[model samples]
Target: MQDNLYDCPEYPLLLILSGPSGVGKDTVARMLIERRPDSFYFVVTATTRPPRDNERDGLDYFFVNFDEFAHMIETNELLEYAIVYNDYKGIPKQQIRDALASGRDVILRVDVQGAATVRHLIPNAISVFLTTRTEGGLVRRLHQRKQDTQEGMALRTATARQEMKRLAEFDYCVVNPEGRPEVAVERVLSIIDAAHCRTHQEPVRL
Candidate 1:
C-alpha cells in the first residue's frame, strides 16, 4: 500500500498564461481563478501604468510610479520585468515564492515578452499562449476598445502580429473566441490536469 501510494504525488505548478495585446489573456486568467479558487493563485503584476476607474490597486495590479518601479528594478524584487508600451511592468518575486510554498498552482498573466523571460528563469514552468481565432478578429477587438489613438492602435497591431509568430515557443496554444472566455478557461484547466499526471513530473523550483 505504501509503495502504491508513492507512485503519484502532486507538485505545485507554475503556469504562464500569455499572448499578444488584445487577446483575452486577462479574461481567461480571471475565469481560471474563479473556477479553481482554492487550488490556484493568480499573480498580481506590478506596473507603472495608472489603473482604470474600476481597477483596484493591489487586486488588479500593483500600481506604482516610475521612480518606485525603478527602485524595484534596482533592488531585484521582480522575477521578470519589461518595458511594455512605454510603461514598466513586472512580476513580484515574493508573491510567487510564497504561493508556491503554500502548494497552490501559480498563474501568471503576462505579455509575450515577459512570458519568455519567466520561461527562461523557470524552465519547468508550463506556458500557454492565448490567441484570437484570426488576426482580423484581434485587430477588430483592439479597435472596439476605442481608447487608443490611431497611431497607438497601429503600433499595437504591428507588435501583436510579431508576437503571434512566437507561438511556437509556448507549450500550448488556446484560441479564445470572442465572448467565450469560459471555453478557454476549461482548456487551460485541462492542461494543468495533464501536467500533474505526467510520468516524470519535476517539482517547480523558484
Candidate 2:
C-alpha cells in the first residue's frame, strides 16, 4: 500500500456523489462502506420523511419531523438543505466537520440539487455523477424497486431526464449499467484512489 505523504494532522477529502432517484446511489455507498468502513465515513443525511419498513434512524437517515428539521435550518446547522417531494432533507455541518477533523474521507450521497449546493459551498470538493447507460435501463431498475405507483414512476422518470442534463457540471461521471452495481462501486473506488495520488498533495482542509 502506498502511503499518503502530505498527510497533515487532519486531512479531509469531501466527495459528493449524486444521481437520479432510482440509479442506485445508496446501494453503491453501502458497498463502499462495507468494503472499508475504517477508511471512509459515509455522511447520513437528515430527512423529514418517516422511516420505511427496513430503514433505521441513524443508519439509513437521521429521520426527523418537520418542526425539528425547520429548527435545524433556522439555526443554520445544516451545510445544505432542500425540500424533496414535500420532505425536507439536509446535511448537518457538524457531522461533516467531525468526520473531516478525524482525517477521514467523507462521502455524501445527495440529490443533484443538493450536490450543486455543496459544490458552491466547497469549491474544491470532488463531485461525481452516477447514471445508467441507457434510459431503458434506468426505467427497468425503477420498476424492480416496486416502491412507486405508475404516476410516481412517471414523475421520477421525468426528473431523471432533467438530472441527466446536469451531468456536465460534475468532475466525473460513472455509468452504472443495469445489474452491475459492484462494477460501479469499483469504478468510483478507483477514481478516489487516483484523486488521492494527485500531484498536489494538499487535501481539501475544510
Candidate 3:
C-alpha cells in the first residue's frame, strides 16, 4: 500500500481488464501473457458458479460453493466481489497482494461490475474496457457461446447494454474484433509501456 507515485515500480502493476460478456477480454489477456510469459501474471478469480467441463479449481477459477464464498466475504478476504447472473465472483485480496509483491505485473480478467469495485479498492490500478468493433458483433458473439438459453441471452444483452454506459469509467479502451485478439493485445501492451515511461504519474496505490 505505497503512496507517493515517485517510488512506484515500473513493473508489478495490477491491471484490471473488463468488458461486457463476449467481448473476448480473456482471449486478449491470454495473448498478451503468451507474448511475454515472463512479464505478466494472470490471476484466476474466485467464483460460486460451478466449473464447466475441463475447468479446474484454482486455475480457471477458485470454484467454491455458496458457504465458502460467503465465508470469504464475511472474513473480508475478497478485494472485491459481485453477483453476476445470480452467481458470486470475486478477486481474493491476499492473492493479488502476493502477486504484486512477487514483482510480476498482474492482470485480472473481471466482470464489468467487479472491475468497478476493484478500481475503488486499488485506486491506481489501470482499468481497460475491452469491446468489440460493433454492438451487433457483441450480440453475435454472445449467441455463439451456446451456453446461454434464449431467456439467458436476452438477459445478458440487456445487461451488456447497461454495462456499456460505464465505459467512461475506464482509463482506456481497446477494441477486440472477432477473431483478432492479437491486435488488442499489442494495444494493451503499448498502453502499459506508455504508462511506465511517463515521468510524472501517480503510482498504483493498492
Candidate number achieving the greatest TM-score relative to the actual structure: 1
lDDT of 1 by residue, 1-206 (tens): 34555568679999999999999887888888899899999999999998877789998899999999999999999998999999999999999999999999999999999999999999999999999999999999999877789999999999999999999999999999898888888999999999999877778876
TM-score of each: 0.96, 0.92, 0.91
Q: CA lDDT of each candidate? A: 0.93, 0.88, 0.86
1 or 3: which has the higher TM-score? 1
Model 3 spans with C-alpha error above 4 angstroms: 1-11, 201-203
lDDT agreement of model 3 with the native: 0.86
> Candidate 3: which pairs clash?
none
Q: Please give, for residues 1-206, the per-residue lDDT of candidate 3 as tens digits.
A: 87766654465678899999989887888787889888888888899888878678887799999999999999999888888999989888887777777777889999898888888878878889999888899999999988788999999999999989999999999999778788899999998888777665554555
TM-score for candidate 3: 0.91
Q: What is the lDDT, from 0 to 100, of the residue 16 in candidate 1?
A: 95
Which of 1 and 2 is ahead in TM-score?
Answer: 1
TM-score of 1: 0.96
lDDT, candidate 2, 1-206, per-residue tens: 98877653334678899999899999999998898798889999999988878899999899999999999999999999998877899999888888887888899999999999999989878899999999888888888888778998888889888999999999999988677889999999998887777756455644
